[model samples]
Target chain A: MSERAQEGRTAEGPTAGEGRTAGGGHGTGGGPGRVLVAVYGVFALAAGARAAVQIARQFDEAPLAYTLSAFAAAVYLLLAVALGRGMRRLALVACGIELAGVLIVGTLSLVDPEAFPKATVWSGFGSGYVFIPLVLPVLGLYWLSRRR
Target chain B: MIGPLATGLIVFALVIALASLLTTALNKSMGTVLLVALGVLEIGLLVQAGFVVAALAAGEGPTDTATLIGYTAGTVVIPPVAAFWGVGERSRWGPAVIAVAGFAIPGMVGRMLQIWQGMG
Candidate 1:
């Protein structure tokens, strides 16, 4: 049955095949790259909406955490768009910043928990998110370098 | 909002995620079984959403109704989109996309449960 779906995709797979065949289109679209884009898109939407609500509802309760959430959300959005467009340089920069942000925020949250009265997406290396926030940048960096 | 139903959906999503992940690990594309499983999950999620909406209308659910509804709507949408995108790719990552969506559904549903309880 899966074979039927596989055949269906091949029957209409110009975009997928073109993603690989089209020169200089490594990052924008392809097999693994498409997965990455999808993951990033989900994260962007999740994080962005979370930050918006947190900030709008009670910014004073945890301004730092909410702001950082907003920042992380923006980064995820940029990374998703940059990767989808195959903007290698921008994607690289975004991945680097994300790595740095997670590390810094993770450490800070651990050392001075009071600073984050509420949890941001990066808090505790995204433990609330099953640590994907910590791991995604590492994967992104590896994927980007491999593409280059 | 519905206790056992929420747990059932979460477990169902988790199982689907694990199956999809297994396919990706084996370097196989998503199969018909997985697609059908996803469709079923989506339908279950919609049913869950309907229940949540009905509960909210009766003023028996979370105080953060907006967020709860957002999560419910988002959860219902992920599976079909992932399936559509997954079928487009012919590689292991095609299943990888489904795996991600499968994982996301449980996570989102869990959050919705938490919101319904006002645990956040």
Candidate 2:
């Protein structure tokens, strides 16, 4: 997808009335865009699976934390979709939400360790995942903004 | 949890990651050589997995079976996934993806070993 397409721009390029693409337009065979989609897909799978397992294994132990994990995973999936479909507005929203989630969760987990009896994907700023959770949002936002 | 073999793998992965990062920084894309290196790394991981399984069969396994298996399996998955994504771009980011995957392997492996040793 072209950079304009990534920003949810119409054929006229960044003009008004360009409805967000329902899905990413990235699977066009081969390119940097496809590679980005693939990486996002990997994160989607990892976060989704991890959250599912956490929720399944012990939802009662820490409902908030696990639910947050699920939420983060959902956001990641959405971000992947947005980027893939070249839905710039949706991608921007999702990436913004991701950044917010990481910051909020990161702060809360640090402030009150007891609240997070179990670690979520964003706990300790995603220390468990080697801080990629924290870093990914920044990259996503940068990628999106560059198109704008 | 921190065996020599596992450590060796982690270090090797880190080295590869550094190489990838440097290459990508230089605007170089992942090419045939890097792809072959990744393949070789995958083969090495499979061999390591086989060794671990054999050791377990001999009753010298790590403490946690399931987590150990999960880690072992995870290590094997990273390279191909990265390569699949990496090859398509043909840009510096292609190798960047490889770098990320390469770095992740050692950390995951180390964590798995820790779990196996009942440390985590």
Candidate 3:
């Protein structure tokens, strides 16, 4: 009987928390949106580190690609912060830029291979990064809309 | 960088990630099991980070020190931050966040191994 009661309390915990968070106007900073923010934060670190290393060590190797990586990193970092802070407008703008960036870069990388001697995060729809770069912004926008 | 440690951490991380996903799917919130598992993963990563840093200090490791160090830093930091963020949620998504960290740890560790091997 005690064990069953413990299990009941454990299961009841999350549902109550979820409702309070959703109704609290936390927007993009609550519930499943929290997961989205974490993913974005990880991507931000990954992209930023990649860009930092490339720019620091071999800027001359592929200036255009490296520069684009830096730009992508900035955007990701911005989106992560905006969403976490519940700044909808900034998050929306960041997501829009990210979606546009990946589609454009993914298409360009395939259509003009030589033009991109090196890969940016968005190359081939983020094929190089498991395509999370491709899917993340869409998820961000969707989660934001749903939360709103 | 001990080759076996990276491989072991990869295995451990994936297991934790899968378990976290299972918790989420079951509609369960974050529990002591996930936190303890994450703690174990964090300790393992810290051990690896110590070795890598020691190797670097001894004038060893890949020529691409910056990237390798970056990966090391990422691996060490991600878990605790995930725990902090996940714990605050008190929902199924809490475990989901931990799951993301679990998945990311292996990728970074694998990359760090590759870098240490001078492969990439």
Candidate 4:
């Protein structure tokens, strides 16, 4: 499957393929990139909607946690857009922030449970999310680094 | 939402996901059969969503309406979007996109079930 895709690209010449697909290159949001973008897009929607609702209904309950949720969503959204658009620098930064967020928030939620009245996406290293939140950033970084 | 219907949807979607993965592994693109399968999944999701709405309207559901609505909406929307995204690729990864959607639906639907059970 991948071999054929590579052949198609080579037959078209690198520049021609890039021009035709636009950002639809492996380094960007084509092939496996599409899967990554889809996952990130889902996370963005999930976290963003959850944060929006929490903030609207009861911001007083856990302002910091909801704010963090919103922040995480924003990062995921940025990463999705960056990867889709083939903006490596933007994707890299977003991935870095995501990695840092899950780790720091995960540890904080654990080491000091009282500080978090409610859970954020990063809380417990995204245990509530089956650790996808913890793993996604690392995957994003690896993908970006491997991209040509 | 209806319990058996939701659980059945989850199982069916998982099967479809595995099928999509098989297609990808076999170096095939997204085919009409898979698209129709996705359409079937979408129909099931819509039915589940409709039930949720009906239950909520009669005040026969959980107190966490906000989360419930959020998840329900997500479950309904993902399949079509994934289908559209998958169809655009014209490569093995096209079905891989479908595979992702297939997996996501079960998770979201299962969450809806849990929330509906008032376990949260």
Candidate 5:
């Protein structure tokens, strides 16, 4: 973790300078945008932590669900970083993938509960997560479009 | 782990979160009050972390020790990181970020309790 923090600090060094000059771009620099990015970051960490635990401890119990959990975590992370960095197009792409993932996974979980031995981040549109998964991408898309 | 202590931690976090949210909604830049609120909350979180670690060492926690410890450590770290970002931004969004971090602590603590109780 310390190593990762060190790497992140070094990586952020140049980008932070670039961000200063990139001024007034589509980055999530303001209040509402920062809130959205914060939510995305929270979800990323939550899903990623859950996936790590599930995979590390009980992979055999629900391999597919755990794998999907990992995937959702990755998508959340990508969207958060891209939006934070002002990569509007990349954020858009990530949000599109997230929306599709939620819809497809949510529907599949509902249609055949047995298909998922355990719940993933997108299960039932993230009911366990207060349905944020169902709504976040829509909000992301709206915010991205407005910023554009 | 410790019932009343956990409740105290959550309530404190929520109060700070609400205060931060109010600042953001009112379009105020992050202020001394907000920083003080966050500082208090971080102290509470660290105390909670200490209690959790002691309880775990006493063999009073979940079978999944790694995950439980991860959550405990994560909760303690979040406030400082959020504070750094919030203080750096100097915009309304700075408080917004702090609000998110503030809200997140309670949720993480709730989950940690669940994990400690073997609810997973």
Candidate 6:
């Protein structure tokens, strides 16, 4: 982790000057980063627990939807850990994956409702979560870019 | 659950949460008074939980036992977790965590009521 942090610092040397002018702090460990991490942690726990219970109870009902729930939960968990640990590379990768998942799943669910049969976290671009899933990845990406 | 009691508690929690949010927005440290208020809210939630359990024992129970238990457990867990994290930071974010937790409590309680009433 220290090595990665050093690499990030080196790669971001040029942007650091611009960042200071923009009121940016030390990477993704700043004040807004802390709050965002907390919120992500909350969603991770909530979505993971809900998916676990749903899959354990009735995996036979709609395997596709339940599996998607599990996938979304894993992504959330990974995003939370990446953000908390301040792993720039891992955070960027996870956030990108999250964005792709939400977009793909959202599109699939819309284009073919019968295939979904049930709603997952990313269904309709996370309508059930007040569209936070859609918005969070964008913020995550911007936060990462700012750190760079 | 008593409707009035639940509504009153929810309102109280909302007020507390909003106050906490304001303190954070002003970039102020979380003081002892806010901590005490959070303690009071936790105590109230515990009391409400006790009442809920008693009512269940007296045959006023929700249909889905597991979900109800989940909410009950979440209510007990959230406040302390928030307090622990909040105290650790000791910054404006500390009170912000409390604000989130406070808002969560009323939402959970409202869900519990809906579950009990078969509206969920």
| Comparing 1 and 2 on lDDT, the stronger one | 1
Model 3 regions more than 4 Å off = A1-25
Q: In order, what DockQ does each candidate have?
A: 0.29, 0.15, 0.50, 0.45, 0.28, 0.22
What is candidate 4's lDDT per residue for A25-141, written digit by digit as tens?
A: 455777777788889989998899899989999999989999999999999999988988788899998899999999999999999998998999999999999999998998888
For B8-112, candidate 6 gives per-residue lDDT tens digits of 778888988999899887876568878888888788888878888888788778776666766777777777877765654444666787887778778888988
Docking class of 6: incorrect
Residues A67-139 of candidate 2: C-alpha lDDT, one tens digit per residue: 8878887887787677767777887888888888888889999999999988888889989877888988887
Query: What lDDT tens digits, residue by residue, belong to model 1 across residues B30-120?
Result: 7999999999999999899999988888989867877887788789878988898787666777888888898888889989989888995
Q: Is candidate 2 or candidate 4 better by TM-score?
A: 4
User: Worst ten-residue run, lDDT, model 2 chain A?
Assistant: A8-17
Collision pairs in model 2: A23-A85, A24-A84, A24-A85, A25-A84, A25-A85
Error of 3 at B26 (Å): 0.6
Judged by DockQ cut-offs, is candidate 3 incorrect, acceptable, medium or high? medium
Q: Which stretches of candidate 5 lie over 4 Å from their true place?
A: A1-26
TM-score of chain A for candidate 1? 0.85
Model 3 C-alpha lDDT per residue in residues B1-30, reported as the tens digit of each score: 998889999999999999999998897879
Instruction: Give the 10-residue window scoring lowest on summed lDDT in candidate 3 chain B.
Output: B85-94
What TM-score, computed on C-alpha atoms, does each candidate reach? Answer: 0.87, 0.76, 0.91, 0.91, 0.87, 0.80
lDDT of 5 by residue, A61-132 (tens): 999999999999999999878877778788999999999999999999999999997999899988988899
Candidate 3 local distance difference test against the native: 0.86
Question: What tens-digit string does per-residue lDDT give for candidate 4 at B76-120?
Answer: 899999998787776777899999888888988888889899996
Q: Total backbone clashes of model 5?
A: 0
lDDT scores for all predictions?
0.83, 0.71, 0.86, 0.86, 0.80, 0.75
Please, what's the RMSD in Å of model 1?
4.6
After aligning candidate 5 to the native by TM-score, how far in Å is the CA of A73 from where it should be? Answer: 0.8
Full-model lDDT, candidate 2: 0.71
Off by over 4 Å in 6: A1-30, B54-60
